[model samples]
Target: MTRDAGQMPEELERAQRFAWDMESLYGDDLVSVVLYGSAARGEYRRGASDLNVMVLVRELTPAALRRAGQRARDWVAQGNPTPLMLSHDEWLRSADVFAIEVADMREAYHVLAGADPFAGITVDPADLRLQCEKELKGKQILLREQYLLFAGEPAELGGLLVRSFSTFLVLFRTVLRLSGEAGVRDAEEVVLKVAARAGFNPGALLEVHRARASGQPPRPTADSPLAVGYLDAVDRVVTYVDRLVREGGAQA
Candidate 1:
């Protein structure tokens, strides 16, 4: 069972109850219904975050997939992202390809039902670093394209900055971990520390964070000081990640 559902918000409590329903539906075949990501890490924000769950089962047969699919759709209807449904064996074998995800989940997760599927799991730091590099580079290209698409409209650009800043935060945390800074989890603090270490000004990221927290537009217009600073901050981060990748070399 999960740590008292009453401790969570109503939406999360309802999601936990739904996981329990899955346990009843699958019985012995269901290995676990685990809560991961922001909610499990105790940093969840109501109406702004996802309830990420993983449903592991012993088998991945067609019948099992169908049942899990239906349940996942129902869960999505309740405003949660579709749960990751995998067999126990598959989950055990995916560590190499999913090192970053595995490490994050291993750091903090709640076992909502059945056995703990992630227990004793280990992720390779080399694999994690490589993936982080790839993700950072890929995201930088995508961010440039997205900025071009929405830079004309101040509201859209501001919204883009607010929404995509989280992705940058995730990468910042990963880079910090790769650089031997452990147990640093707060998103804003991570950005600040990373900026200081990487020798880039964090004023822009801080402004965006404050605006995001206050539920306001990032700035009056894309040509405004905040938007320009935000783009510069993002560009500097991209350069930082690129340098790390070059230094780490291709050894994964």
Candidate 2:
């Protein structure tokens, strides 16, 4: 019983209802029920996709996480599927383990019957920006190395192009999150929105996309035209943060 974007509201309501039902049976120990993955991002298909969810609880006794796991398995056995149940410690500690993407945060609604202990959980925008920048720096280095390594091979060039485009999507999504915009499932849509709101040039982003589509070896240089577009996008993000700091100072 998953659905597509148009049917998201109904699906979300059902998920909330399911969370409530679980809370009633399990008592007040449950922290929150988070709907994750593509369905959470309003991209599920009725016939093909399973809903991904995380049930975060205060302290699951050794028996409880196991029981929860068994219950989830049973749900799948019944032809309704969901993913893991995580305790509070696991979720918080794992939050910074990787570059958080649009798919990671979209459609996250808290469904809790009673007072939620995790209600005040806030992901600092500054922290997210730093994490994103760190990831971007790493990807930029990796892409440059890969390009040099297989400069003559068309197949390797194509693979590097794909990786670079994927990294661009991650960078764009991170900017969206920093700006308090909900994550978008579509990479192109996210890039367009980032360009519009974050003072980036959309034409530049489209150029990167076009280069990626061409399946050609990128020109190698310190200031390669292909690299310029991505670099410009990164500059826009830095400019955005600088503007925010200035505006905040003025307000103060």
Candidate 3:
């Protein structure tokens, strides 16, 4: 997908300005301020999604972070409307647990008042790749085992569907981990990249997504050729990731 420049709505602009004012009021100790998540990814709706952002400081006191969060909530309560304010350190430490995306606006990122914390943060690409490989492999194993148990049990389709969603979640997480920089909410964006790197075909997986979106039942039994095909594709994904890790280690 093509990257587009961030276009702030008037309300968002007001929120940003308010954030900047808060930073100044607290003195210029704000190390960095970033817009992140879906809003940063250009997928957010003005009224539906809250403005997600991160405020970084050289030394963010627990009290300070709490105060900042409260202030943001209070501002939104006043009808300014935007759930803004997250601390950078807190965000980084918990990023792996949640589906948060980093904003990609290095050149045009409005500094507001301080330096960019990411300016010198060197993320090792190889390390990221290996971490994602490990995580994806683990997820594949779990999904395979779960699907095997659910097979032929059409009555348990709902549970199976939830598990299938989990499969997509794991795949999405792996992509985010590999990229280091996040903001990929759509599975379509990273599925191909992950599949190619791990030697799995994305087409088959996409079929599953299409079926799910269409509200069709997933095939998980041997009787259902589609289900069997999906399972086979998933297995291949696991094997491919395992081989990649093994080969990479041998080269190292």
Task: Tell me the number of clashing residue pairs for each predicted model.
Answer: 0, 0, 1
Worst 10 residues of 2 by lDDT: 243-252
State which candidate has the highest TM-score. Answer: 1
- Compared with the true structure, the alpha-carbon lDDT of candidate 2 equals 0.58
What residue runs in model 1 are displaced by over 4 Å at the alpha carbon?
A: 2-4, 249-252
Sort the candidates on TM-score, descending order.
1, 3, 2
Error of 3 at 47 (Å): 10
Against the true structure, candidate 2 reaches a TM-score of 0.51
Query: What shift in Å separates residue 57 of candidate 3 from its native position after superposition?
Result: 1.5
lDDT (CA) for every model shown? 0.78, 0.58, 0.53
Residue 117 accuracy (lDDT) in model 1: 81
Top candidate when judged by lDDT against the true structure: 1
Tens digit per residue, CA lDDT, model 3, 1-252:
112214656544654675575676456666666654435445444443445555666556777666566677776776544543445565455333332122223212344445665554443444545655666667667766766776768646434643465345445544444434254456556666656655666665666655555556454454555555555666666666466556653111
Task: Supply candidate 1's per-residue lDDT for 212.
Answer: 72
Q: Which prediction has more favorable lDDT, 2 or 3? A: 2
